[model samples]
Each structure stands twice: as C-alpha cells, then as structure tokens.
Target: MTGTAGDVIRIAKSQVGYHEGYSGGHWTNLQKYSPAVPGLEWSQNQAWCATFAAWCFQEAGMPKGSYPVTASCALGVSWWENAGRFSDYPGIGAQVFFGSGGGSHTGLVYAYDADFIYTAEGNTNSSGSAEGDGVYLKKRARRDTYVYGYGYPSYPTGIVTADPAWKNPTAPSQQEEAVALTDDDIKKIGRQVVTGANGAKSPDDPTVEWAMSSFLGLTYKTARTIAADVAAVKAKVESLSVGGVDLDALAEKVADKLAARLAE
Candidate 1:
C-alpha cells in the first residue's frame, strides 16, 4: 500500500475535539501555522473551516498537485476543479464540500457509509452549522442537500483503516535509540523516501535504497543488497535500476515521521 490515504486520515484524526477559543484565538493560532493564507488581518471571529482543511493537507505532506491548501472554500473548490480531482464519490482523505450554487463549508472525510458520511470539520460543532465553535467529527447524510461533492487526493494504497474514527495515540518507547534521530532527520528521510516512491520519477528514486541502508545503520553496498532482498520479499520490484528493491514498507515506515515534519 502507498499509505498516503492512511497518513492523511491519521493526522486529521489526531485533532478531533479541537475547538476555537473566545474571539477565535484558537482558530487564529491554526491560521498562523498555515503559510498559504497570509497578509490578511485574521480575526478569531473569521471563518476558519477552510483554514483547518488547508493546515491538515499541509501537515499530511501532500504535494499541491495532490492537495491544495487554501482558506476560501470557493478557492479550494476552484483548485480541485482545475486539477480535475473533484468528484461525487467520497474516498478517505477526500475534502467533502458543502452548500450549493457556490460552496459553503468544507471538511476532511474520515469515514463513510451508504447512508452517511463521517467528517472532521472546522468552525463547526455538534449542531453541524458552518458558523460554530470549533473542529468536530460529525456525521451527515450522503444525500444531504448541502453536499457539493469532493476534492479527491491520490493515495498510495494501505493507510486507510476500517475503523470509522481516529484512534488514540500509541505509547512512546521507553527504550531510547543509541543515537536518537531528531524530528528533522526523520522528516527529511521520510520526504526523500516518499518522493522517491511517489514522485514522477517512480522506482528510480534513490532514497528507497538509501533509506533502507540508513535505517539498518549500514553504509555499504552489501547492506543495501540485503535490504533490497528483504524488501523484495514484500512486493514486486522486478524492474528499473534497483531491479529487486521494493518500497511498499519503506513508504509506510516513513509516513508518520514525514507527516510530523510537515506539521513542523
């Protein structure tokens, strides 16, 4: 599995109960971290569902070609429409838009069923109105008139979970590494590895081979060969320069770290 869908949903699920504070202080802080929306004098009272969506995509390490980060729902819609990714079918990590004629609110789709679509929305609450207190995970009918389609982001394959909601965090390791890798190192390694797999270049991406050696703490050719052997056991990597190398697990290993890096 490419794991991109799982990665995006995991990040969004991490922020389920987040709410905006008085005068929108909380939402403003979310906006501050998003580089895409700038210069405008942002007020706590301003609409921020779009801001949250953009920030989540940014945090997911999704490239603009796959996901556009923007504050205006209309603008966000335009971006997906331009990319030809807008569609009626809601898939994991697809941006579910609401309203009609133009658009109103937007959110990241978490889970869905024939009758309803589960969502993680910002500037909304239990009442499910666009103008609300903060971020929430809500359920809306699939046939709800407010539904305006979606922005479908491409994913690698395996990350999507059967569970309908985000799971709790995993326990931290009590045993530390001999040399602990910094967040930056993890993120860099992840980006290099993912881009190597998912980038336009495909199997030619060097980091696939490079990361395995690094993860094994090996710097020699033999180590990479062994790594390729281990990877090849998992998936078909029969062609290209690294004839026997595989990347399915490599991408999953780096997904969470790469996601954290995007948040940074």
Candidate 2:
C-alpha cells in the first residue's frame, strides 16, 4: 500500500520471473518451487490468498501479520468487517475476493486493463503444478463477466476494502472460490482417523492434510503443516500403488468437503 501500482507490478514481475513452473502437488513443492529459483524465495502455498499475501509481504520486507482480521483484504470484494486495509479501495496491491461463503480464492490485485484485471496467483488450475502452468499471469474479466466486485484499504488498512463495480447478478459459486481452511483446522477433524500416535505430535496423516492445505492457501503455522504432509506423501509415494485417484473424483471430494463445512 505504501508504493505505487507500478511498484507492485514490478515486484510481481520480478517474482514471476524467478521460477520454472512445476506440477503444483505435494504442498511442499512450493518450498523448492519458489526460493530455489530467484525472486520468490518466500512465495508459498497458504490457506488462502490473504495468507499468501501475508507471506509475500514478509518476503518483500512489508510488515506482516500486523492485523489479524485484515486478511480479508486479500480477496476481491473485501467486506472490511474487520478494521484493516483494502476495506476501502481497489488498488494494485489489494486482495481480491470473489463469491460468497466459507472460503474464496485470494489473489494479489496485480495489473488491470480498462476491462479486465490481471492477477498473480499461486494455486489455481487443475494440474496443481507449481509455477502455475508455466504462465505467470491470469486475467479476470472486469466488465461483462462475473467480476463480483473490487476493494481497497482505508484505515490502518493493510488489506483491501470493497468497491462495487460489476453489474453481473450471478456471483461465482462457493465451490468456484472455496479452498480448505488451514492445515491445523483440517487436522482437527482428521483426528478421528489417527490410531498409533502418542502425544508426541498430531497423528493425523500429513499427506491428506498437505494436499488439502495446499489446495487452500498456505497460512502460517498451517503452511509448515503442509510441508510435513508433503514429506509424508513423497515418503510413501513409491510404496503406494496407483489406483482410482481420478481427478473428477478428487474434485467431487473437495466439493463435498467444502459443501459440508460451509453448511456447518
């Protein structure tokens, strides 16, 4: 928020240039996917865009985690229900929120044309690969499409606030925007599956947690949880046989889980 829109674009360009895209799987892939290259040493997968935004701020020498509720600023349509940034205007560095519900995909408000918004996102697409299909940019249509809204920061606003721009009545579906909460939250429910664990650490299998967490945005403590989960997946991948891991089935599982949680 301190710098101009051009500054944000420059930083984003630098970050995007730093990596060679990879299949974005096993949440920990980002660890090597980001830093090993160059500009994105801190680029990570989090529970949502806000947390990813927080990580970017930390990496780029911006104040991070200073405001708890302001994380919503990372979305497209910021409610600013909390006293944070982005609750006021739609700027280059604000968070973009879409849809309405339990979880929404968050992204850095990178660049914009007269009729569209160009975004820098980490965890989108079906391949779930790192570097994001090797193309460092994605665009959200602004005018006639389902743009929902825009947001900016007003107060001590480190996040974004809302701006009503589009006229489309059909908001994106919650499933279109939903990602899991953070790893810790999901592990809390996975506790029912643990059998052999002592009080040493959480017995919840880390692979599922990491997959789900990375599917979300890499939050703080939850980010590390994803790392451990990825480790578990890699550790067991050779031993596990290939089976009915169909993507549509996987998507259905994700949708069902999100639906159940949102309902709750």
Which one is best on lDDT? 1
For residues 92-131, write the lDDT of model 1, one tens digit per residue. 7888899973268999888888888898888887899887
How far residue 134's Cα lies from its native spot in candidate 1, in Å, is: 1.1
lDDT per residue as tens, model 2, 127-149: 42222332245677655333444
lDDT, candidate 1, at 221: 57
- What candidate 1 gets wrong by more than 4 Å, as runs, is 1-3, 23-45, 158-264
Q: Which stretches of candidate 2 lie over 4 Å from their true place?
A: 1-7, 17-29, 32-49, 65-79, 84-89, 125-135, 143-148, 151-264
Global lDDT of model 1: 0.67
lDDT of the candidates, in the order given: 0.67, 0.45
TM per prediction: 0.53, 0.38
Strongest candidate by TM-score: 1
**Model 2: number of backbone collisions:** 40
